[model samples]
Target chain A: MFDQLVAKLPVGICVVDEQYRLQYLNAFFLDRMRPDQRHNYLQQPLISIFPEQAKFLTRRIKSVFVLQHPSFSYWEQRAHIFPFKSSRPITGEETQMYQNMEIVPISGPSSEQKLACIILQDVTAQASYLMAQQELASALKQEHTAQRKLIKKLDSAQSQLIQAEKMASTGQLAAGIAHEINNPIGFVTANLATLKDYSEQLLNLCDALADKLQVTSPSLAQFSAQTMDTYHYELLKEDISPLVDESCEGLNRVRDIVENLKQFALEESTGWQLFNLHETTQQLVKLVGAQYKAPVYKVSCNPPNLQIFCEPASIKQALTNILINAAQSIKCKGFVKIDIRATAQRVSIKVIDSGVGISAENIKKIFDPFFTTKPEGMGQGLGLSVAYTAIEKHKGKIIANSNPGRGTVVEILVPVVHPEQRHECAEPLGGS
Target chain B: MSTESVLTADQRDALQELMNISMGQAANSLAHLIETKIGISIPKIASVTPEQLFSMISEQADAYYTRQSFLGDIQGEVMSVVSQQGLCEVGALLEYDAPLSQTDIQEIILELSNILAGACLAGLSAQLALGTNLNMPTLFSPRKANFEEFQWSNSLVMEVQFDIEISSFSMRVVFCLDDASLDRLTQTLDELLG
Candidate 1:
């Protein structure tokens, strides 16, 4: 009964000797073999029967014989060690059988003869199911990574859109305000000049009348002098001219501010042309220095006459904005150095300032519109953002590095726009 | 109360001697098979809680682990910790090619554990006149195991180490018998002492 059960077991059982020659094959193994080989396979070398897996099979069988212990081969490492077809060949997805082989040392009844028993278990279904699940898991992981990258891209693009929209509307608002202020400034400036001349002439006429009255009638002159003394006429003559001069100066300041607002709105006629970077830096230093006198400004350029093809008006405005920030960053005394270096394809403008630098957190949002650290009513916070927009038009970028209280370095990297590509940028550089 | 006290002084001494002989045989079997000089250290016997067992085995960061179970006159499990250093040299001596694959490395660890553990068990059982059969070994991760939830609070453990002279690699095997098997082992040792 035990012999019958061994021959009829579901698992494949093959007995190979110490020499790895076949000794016996159970019915399970014989059923998978060819009809001719089934009867003749006895006494044949196991390697001759399965030459492809000969090296591996012999090594494992040899280990069992030497160590007098069991040796195992899992389906995960060496699947389908045997040349056997799947039992469920018609319905199974896999063509070959996945086998887990175990070779254990067994001694014959004589005790002198040693043999190894090879037990092979079919694990095709389990192997296939695990592989399919692993594939699905890796595919899901790849899809998740792709989605995360897309979400990050969308977030940055959306923020840029918001910034562009804000800049467009602000540009229109500035243009409108500049127009209204321009008219009043124009008339007020002209009237201040005429008032200055009129006040000077009236003071001279009063002086001449007082001298004539003193010579014409002595007693009448005496009464007139008494009247002049009561009114403090001598003090009035000395202060009148200076008052008119100061009023004219204040009016001129109003006109200069209105001019700047108009430039901020962007002039529609500005076009791409060759502009000298060296000269622009000099002009910018002079202009800002007049207003902020505390910070000493310095300008340097490589290849002294480096002329880059760009929109002169907008480029000037961008530099003016950056220089103003550099000047304002200083409270009492500091130096602002402007360095312009040009490569074959781009020009780098570095503005280094020895002033209170930006903090780490606020540096990121410096290009964002209305992001300011200034006290209320002191700054509009549109300077750096407008500069960023202008540089973006020229396919450029700005990098700011600051050490909180130490200093700040702002680098504007702008691509050199050649005149040949001017037609590609047909749109007027009116509103950045 | 304690695993050491579970056996009388004579039985403990007998058991310790038996363990030394078996471990020496195990090291000799492996050295003969691999054609290398393998050294064995005196086996240490202890009774430990789950936490102690975890700390003892999980202390090595760079080691591969395997666990096998045997059933027969006594039932218990054997855990092996193999150092990863100089494993490739050992693999070459075992007729494996250099630049071993992931599967090759795993197979080496499992096969090496099986040989040492099987030899030790077979030798020890033979001395006690008991029959034991060892099952296949599988890869194990001590970090992932929840030692606190183990059913046994304390168990007698026989620990031994095998050092390969050809490389820096060393293997430590720990044997832990079940509660019922411990009683059987002690009784068998007593009879042998008599």
Candidate 2:
């Protein structure tokens, strides 16, 4: 009964001698072997029977004999040390069996002769299940990374869309306001001119009347002189001309501001064209200087007539907005300098202002739409944002640096050739 | 119950002496197999709370850990702390290639733990005239395990250290026995003492 129990055990059992000759095979092992080998496999070398794993099996069996202790081999290190098919080949994920083997030394009657028993256990289901779980976890990690990247991209695109919508609507509103203000400015300017001429004529007529009355009638002259004294006519005669001239100048300024508004709102007129950077900078400084006379405006260009192909209207608008900010930043005597330089493929413009510089935190949001630190009704906060949008259209870059108490410097870089014309220019240069 | 009262001073001394002989035999077996000299320290026997056990074993920063259990006459576990330093030299002694892969390193660690832990348990069981079988050893991480909710509050712990003379390699083997095993062990020590 004991022998039958050992023979019918579920595990694979094989006994080998010192020379690695198979001495016995249990029923579990014999049933898995070929019909001829099952009947006549006794006393055969273990290596000859299973030559594929002979080297590894022999080494392990030798260790057991030498140490006289049990030696173990796990499936994690060496999965299949035997050439056995899976018990359930059809339903299992793996066709080859995964086995964990153990070798133990046994004595045969006398301690002088040593024998080793090999026990193999199938563990295919456990290993395959664990591997599948690991693969799924790694796949999940990759998907998480890809999703985070997509969310970041979506956030930037949404912000850009919001900025574009605000710019379009603001541009339209500015155009409408400019058009409405244009009519009032025109009539006010015409009326101021006529009033100045009329006041001048009336003053001259009074001077002529005073001289004639003095000569024609002494008594009448005395009356006239008294009336003139009572009215302070000499002071009036001197201040009237200056008052009218100041009014006319003030009206002209209002008209110029309106004209600037119209130019800034010319959204449809923006088109790629060859523009002179030097001339534009000079014009911008002169215009902004007239409004904020406290700051001294200086302009310079390396090549006096350096030209670039770009949207002339928007480029001018962007520079105008930047110059206005520089000029306004100064409360007292300071200098605002514009330096333009042209390289082979690009132009660089630097606007340096000796004014109360922006704080570090404020500089970051200077280009954000509707962000401003100015007092109410002093600024609309759209100036820098508009400039940012215009330059971005041309694929140019703008950067600002400032020291709180010192000053601020704004730098801009624009490509000399438009992207559409870049190909055309490259071909000629290559040929030459 | 107090852990010191579990065994008398005479019993503790006898058990310590028994562990010394068994641990020395384990070191000798390893030396014989590797053809190198190995040194062993005297075994220390104590009763410790789970918290003390966690602190004592988890303090080594650069070490590999393995745990194996044994059953039959007494039920207990063997926890080994193998220093990472000079592991490459130990791998060389195990007939592994110079540049060891992950599988090769794991196999070496498992194999070493098996040979040493198995020999020590076998020697001790033989001296006590008890039958015991050691289960397979597996890699363990003390940091990952939660010790606060451990089932056992206190255990009888036996500790020993082995150092390979040719390299800077050292490993600490700790055996923890349950309450029933502790009782069985002290009773057997009493019989030997009588």
Candidate 3:
């Protein structure tokens, strides 16, 4: 009855003598081995029966016999000590059995004789489930990283959109102001010219009346001359024309400024059109120079009148931003030069200035929105960033080179025709 | 308190001999259950502060620790330190399945401590003609802060080591007697000697 119970045990049990020769095999152990090998395994060395695990088995068994204690081995460290198939070989996830083996020293019926017992237990399902969980965790980590990067891109794009909207509203405001100023300037200009003509007629009438009075009566003429002397008539006649001329010139200047503001705003047509690069550079210099009077503004155009098809207002805005930056960089009495060069298919505008140059560190972040060196409320630091966006729209490149306390140079290159339409044009100019 | 002051030379000798015999019985019980040869070292007796006791147990790196308490004629706690190496072999001998989970390892530590500590306590109690009840075992980590905060100023410690011949496996068991238990133990030793 005891033998039958031991044979039916779920665990694999085998007994080996001190020399490691197999003495007994329970039914669980016999079932795992081939029928022929099972019958012949008795009295055979344990190594010969499972030659592949001979070294490991021998070591464990020897230790058990010498120390007279139990030795343990787990599947985690060494999965299968013996090459055996899983109990559910047909439906199991693992092809081979994952075994935990233990060798224990046992005394025979007589305490003098020593024997080693080997026990095996299978555990494959637990290991497979753990591995699957680890794989899922790693995949989730990768997905989380990708999502973070996409969110960062979306954040930058949203800020750029907001900046563009602000620029559009500012342009509309400028256009409205220019239109209102033009109305008053028109009438003021006309009334000043009419007043100048009416004053000349009044002076001519006074001169004729004095001449007639001198001829008609010497006393009356003498009285009239005395009255004219008391009124300082000669000085008044000399200053009137010069005053009218200066007033007219000043009004003309104001009109010119209003005209430039209207052109800069370009609210009438934002569409693409042919634009003269040299002309745009000159206008940018004038507009910026008015505010930053410390800089001596100069313009140079090689093969003048280089024209490119682009959005005129936007190009002007880009150049204006760069020119103003150059002028403002000067503390006092420095030169700002605008050089325009054109190839057969492209145009390059370079704004060079002798001013307090940017530091090496600040130059790198100058084009990033809201990165400013100026004191609070003095500058918004959006100038270069706005220019960068406008130039990008034209499929152009802009670069800045500067040295601290020396000077700065900003260069912009734009295709003569928009890049998308350049293929239609037979010749393309290479510009740097 | 010093070891000599706690117990006279005769009392110390008598307790040491009794501990040796009880430890041997504990090892035999484990050997009988696993059908393996288990060797035990003679027990060493000492009077130690909590810090000393902590260092003695925690000095063994990569070892599993457990604590059990007993009550009745003697009141004391038993701490067992088992090496992590060759644990798989021990697990198999106990009929545990392969690829032992964390819980399985914990269970093995607890069961091993209970068997060895229980047997030693039972043997000592039987020989002394004292009645004692062993409590369940629990896993313990010997952290310095916790040891420093322990309420006892000093304890009488009896320590022993068990080595298994079949595998490179060894465990140390430490017995600590509370103040009242120490008095009881010395009184019982004197009676035995007399």
Q: Rank the candidates by DockQ, best first.
A: 1, 2, 3
lDDT of each: 0.85, 0.84, 0.82
**How does chain A of candidate 3 score by TM-score against the true chain A?**
0.72
TM-score of 1: 0.75
Q: What is the TM-score of model 1 when looking only at chain B?
A: 0.97
Q: CAPRI verdict on model 1?
A: acceptable
Give Cα distance to truth, residue A324, candidate 2, Å. Answer: 9.7
- Report DockQ per prediction, comma-separated: 0.45, 0.37, 0.07
The candidate that achieves the highest TM-score relative to the unseen native structure: 1
DockQ of 2: 0.37
* Model 3 misplacement above 4 A: A1-124, A207-235, A267-274, A301-303, A310-317, A344-347, A376-382, A389-396, A414-432, B1-194
- Candidate 3 DockQ score? 0.07
| Top candidate (lDDT) | 1
Answer with 1 or 2, whichever has the higher DockQ: 1
lDDT of 1: 0.85
Name the better of 1 and 2 by TM-score.
1
Model 2, runs deviating above 4 Å? A1-10, A18-21, A25-63, A66-68, A83-96, A109-112, A159-191, A217-251, A258-432, B1-3
As a whole number from 0 to 100, the lDDT of residue A209 in candidate 1 is 77
Kindly report, for each predicted structure in the order presented, the TM-score of its chain A compared with the true chain A.
0.67, 0.65, 0.72
